[model samples]
Target: MLKIQDLNAFYGKSHVLRGVNMTVERGEVVSLLGRNGVGRSTLCKAVMGLVAPVGHVEFDGKTISGMAPHDIAHAGIGYVPEDRAIFPGLSVLQNLELGMKKKGQTGEKWTLEKVYEWFPRLKEREHTPAEVLSGGEQQMLSMFRALMGDPQCILVDEPTEGLAPKVVADVAAILQQMAKDGLAVLLVEQKLSIALDIADRIYIMGEGEIVFEGTPEDLRNNPEIRKEWLEV
Candidate 1:
């Protein structure tokens, strides 16, 4: 449902993404796995129109390279950054409402009630300030906030960075449920194991380029592919 072809992005004079090509089919979970500084996040940023790139970012079908960030977000895509960007002072419900704004979207499936159903923790702390949430709670809130927009595809950057093992497992479960429920998920994760647990296909990136891609089993069995691009 999303296509990125020959994508090249630069941060001023520093080029971050080099000829990155990948696609996410409807209801499929495809993950981009790589070590630090490999432009994994940059690829997502470019696709979401957060970073300027020189190529094609087609969602459904139309090009959205030069589109505004809000326009891109409103056009059936949701982004959850690696940092889990949340409003510290705002309440959990308040943070969630930020994504509820509907533009040209129709036939929505996610609402505050649905969000509460998916994440009862957010409901429990609905009136508490975001700063009071634990690390896992913050991560949960971030994911649910993106869901509040009712996006067709969601881009998640390292959803299990600093969490405990149990939290990581929870994240994997949530992402897998999203895929099973017919949402295209593009996950960028440093922890290949966590991603492989939920990802249907994997893209191994090295130095801002995709070096290998296959099913989870193919990646697990190839020693050379692990040696070249994934060992950290």
Candidate 2:
């Protein structure tokens, strides 16, 4: 579980996340939705300690605001950036191996075989170099690599951007499955439909602050909120 209170983040003199308050409970999928330049990604970075933040950021009941990124990860949080960071030269298997926390860590839920089972495409391309995979494959690989760490919660930023409709549906299914399996997912996404379909709770951000917090059905029925903040 993750809880953030009065969180603020800055880029030099410019403040990006302005007093953002949100939480992701265990086994829940919480979607953060907003238009561009609204600091959705910055909130993710601040929670991951990738940027300097001022205020409280607690994960599993401990303060993690000033911890190093690696330390934060070691504490059971995984991050999948919008760019889908993967090693171009590394084979799919090798890329997954890099996600391991250590050589002998045990009791983990994710394994190479399980990853192969979950993603047959990854299994087929197990030995192929990452550079040769299609965009959708690369996105799957990114999420798979993060799962390799056996994280309790994952912060995913823009997982469906630039993908075909089928691939987007695949990605959404995987995210939903993750929550069903008891892992918290803080999904930062731009696509309203996808977020509405999969998220249990939704938070809409605008001008770096949360403007709406409600269930997915509540969001869907409220045309004014959709028009004022979400609709393009």
TM-score of each: 0.95, 0.97
Residue-wise C-alpha lDDT for candidate 2, range 102-206, written one tens digit per residue? 854422778887788878999999999999999999999999888889999999999999999999999999999889888999999999999999999999999
Question: Model 1: per-residue lDDT, tens digit, 127-207?
Answer: 999999999899988988888788889999988989999888888988988888788999999887887788899998899
Off by over 4 Å in 1: 102-107
Best candidate, lDDT: 2
For candidate 2, the TM-score is 0.97
Q: What is the lDDT of candidate 1?
A: 0.88
Root-mean-square deviation per candidate: 1.9, 1.1
**What TM value does model 1 have?**
0.95
Clashes per prediction?
0, 0
RMSD of 2: 1.1
